[model samples]
Target: MKSVLITGASSGIGLQLASDYLENGYRVLACGLDVVKLKAVLSHPNVTHYAFDTTSVEQIDQALGQLSAPDLIILNAGNCEYVNDAQQLDAALFERVMSTNVMGTVNCLSVLLPRMQAGSHVAIVSSSVTWLPLTRAEAYGASKAALDYLARTLAIDLQDASIDVSLIRPGFVDTPLTRLNDFPMPAKISVTDASSRIRRGLERRQRVIDFPFLFILVLRIFSWLPVSWWQSIAASMRRHSL
Candidate 1:
């Protein structure tokens, strides 16, 4: 049986992916920071849980040391915090977001990459917010933008090694994470639909898995607009939110 390891399995997308993989008869190595939550999700016979903070390299190394190499590894553990007041820059908030979303993925790669061989795949969960600047997404958008670059670069670098890298950009998935959002989310999908789409995308070894087709198309189109136009739109969004 092929095995897959997923980080942030405690809740949200990670949790949904873990359950989906397990149901599909794959051996799942579920990693999460919450021990209680991790245990709850590992109720399946084919699933095993590992608790570790993704931001801590030492913790990742120690926890991952016990496991064998997996056929697939999804670095989906991330945190999102908006910059409520861009005029008053929050360096600490920016750092915290980058530390978890960017650095945490790097920490996981350091330990997991060596264990992976040819045919193994790595998936990084980014956000569609990177497509165009959104209100209050300064910290979150920046982190995901960095992840987009990282994943694209890794795709080229890992080609000869036979390890494929997939960049996943989901638009408004209904999860615990999105529940905190105060704004309206258009074309929002349930976690089950998100998981199904992700699994299917991975099975096909897609380089980029961007979801809610219409939403992504809109963003792609908007991203191609003139810089000034986009800037005006963003400014308007901020004003309305205020």
Candidate 2:
């Protein structure tokens, strides 16, 4: 049976994807920082729980050392922290977000890429925030933008190697993390729908898997607008959100 390894499998899209993959007859390696949470969420004959801090390269190497590479690897582990005041930059917050979202994926890839057989697929969970600047997303958006670039670059470099890299840029999904949002979220989808979209995208081996047609479309359109126009709109949005 083909096996898939997913980080951040304890909650949100990662958790949903793990369950969906298990039902589809794939051996699931559910990796999360919290072993107890992983066990509590998933219990299956073909599912194995791996606990490791994705921010730590040593921990990732040690944890994944014993297991052969899986057919698919989804680097979905990430954290979100908004910059409440852009005027007052928070270096610590930026570090925390970057360490988890960007470096965390890099750390995993550093270990897994070598062991992965050719034809294995890797998906990195970036955010739709990269499409257009949003209010209070300073740190979060920057990290995901880095991921977007990283994933695109990897796709080019790994194409000849027979490995595929998918950049998943998801809009708002109804998960615990997004529930904390105080602002409006247009076209937000359920976790089940999000998982289904991601699975279908991966099956087709799409290089960039962005989601929820209307929402992403709007962002794409807005991104094409004049910079000053978008800045004014974004500033207006910030005013209303407060």
Candidate 3:
């Protein structure tokens, strides 16, 4: 069976993806911060549970070192914390978000890439928030924006190595994380739907996979407008939430 390794398999999209992949007959390497929680959520003979703090390089090395690379690797682990008061400039908040979303992924790649065989596929889960800035998403949006660039650049650099890179830009997935949002979420999709879309895209080896068509289309349209115009729209959205 083809093996698939996924980070953040404890919950949300990661959990759903793991379950889906297992059902499809792929050997699963499920990585999470807590082994107990991961096993509680996912228990199967074909599934191997790996516990490691993605933000800690040493932990990742200790857990993943010496293991042969899987056929597919999805760097889906991330943290989402909003900067409610952008004016206050929360350096610590930015650090926490970036540490997990950006640097954490980087830390994984540092170890996993060398072990990956040719023809393997790697997918990066980036948010559609990168397409257009939203209110109070300073840290989360910025981190995903960085992933967008990183994934695209990796696609170009890893081409000769025969390693396919997929950049997944999901609009609003209705996972446990989104349930905590105080603002309205337009076109939010369930975790199952999100997993199906992602699996279809990966099977096709598509360079860019964006979902919930209408939502992404709206963002693309607004992105075409002048900065001032979008800024007005964003301000209106903030007002509506208030």
Candidate 4:
């Protein structure tokens, strides 16, 4: 049976994916910060649980040292915090988001990459927020944007090693994370739907897998608009929010 390792397996999309993969007969290495939560979801015989904070490099290294090389590694652990008042500029909030989303992924990569072989694949969970500037997403969007670039660059660099990289950009999946959002989320999908789409995309080995067709289409269109136009729109939105 093929093996896969998923970070953030305690809840949301990660939990769903871990369950689905177990059902499909793959051995799963489930990593999450919450030991209780991680154990609750990973009850299957094929699933092994590792409790480690993604923000801690030492923790990631120790956890990874105990596992064998996985055929697929999903670096999906991340947190999102908005800049509610950009004028105030919450540097702490920005640091927290970047530490978890960007540095967290890097920490996992440092430990996981060396163990992966030529046929192994790495999937980075970015967000569709990177497609356009959105209100209150200053920190969250910037982090995912960095991840998008990192995944693309890894794709190019890992080509010679035959290690495929897949970038997953989901449009608001209805997970615990999004449950905290105060704004309306268009085309919000269930965790099951998100996991299904992501697995299918991985099977096809697509470079980019963006979900909810219409949502992605809209974002892509907006991304094509002139920079000044989007800037004006963003500024107007910021003012309205104030």
Runs off by more than 4 Å, candidate 4 = 235-242
- Residue-level lDDT tens digits of model 1 in 1-242: 99999999989999999988988999999999988889975688898889899999999999997667899999999998988877899999998999999999999999999878999999999999999988889899999999999999999999999999999999999988899988778899999999999999999999999998999999999999999999999899778767
Worst 10 residues of 2 by lDDT: 60-69
Write down the lDDT of every candidate, Cα atoms only: 0.93, 0.95, 0.94, 0.92
Q: List candidate 3 segments past 4 Å from native.
A: none
Deviating ranges (above 4 Å) for candidate 1:
none
Best by lDDT: 2
Give each model a TM-score: 0.98, 0.99, 0.99, 0.96
Estimate, for each residue in 1-242, the C-alpha lDDT of model 3 and write its tens digit: 99999999999999999999999999999999999999999998999999999899999999999899999999999989977766798899899999999999999999999988899999999999999889988899989999999999999999889999999999889888888898889899999999999999999999999998999999999999999999999999988987
lDDT of 4: 0.92
What tens digits encode model 2's per-residue C-alpha lDDT throughout 90-138?
Answer: 9999999999999999999999998888999999999999998888999
Listed per candidate, the RMSD to the true structure in angstroms reads: 0.9, 0.7, 0.7, 1.3
Model with the higher lDDT, candidate 2 or 4: 2
State the lDDT at 202 in candidate 4: 96
How would you order the candidates by TM-score, starting with the best? 2, 3, 1, 4
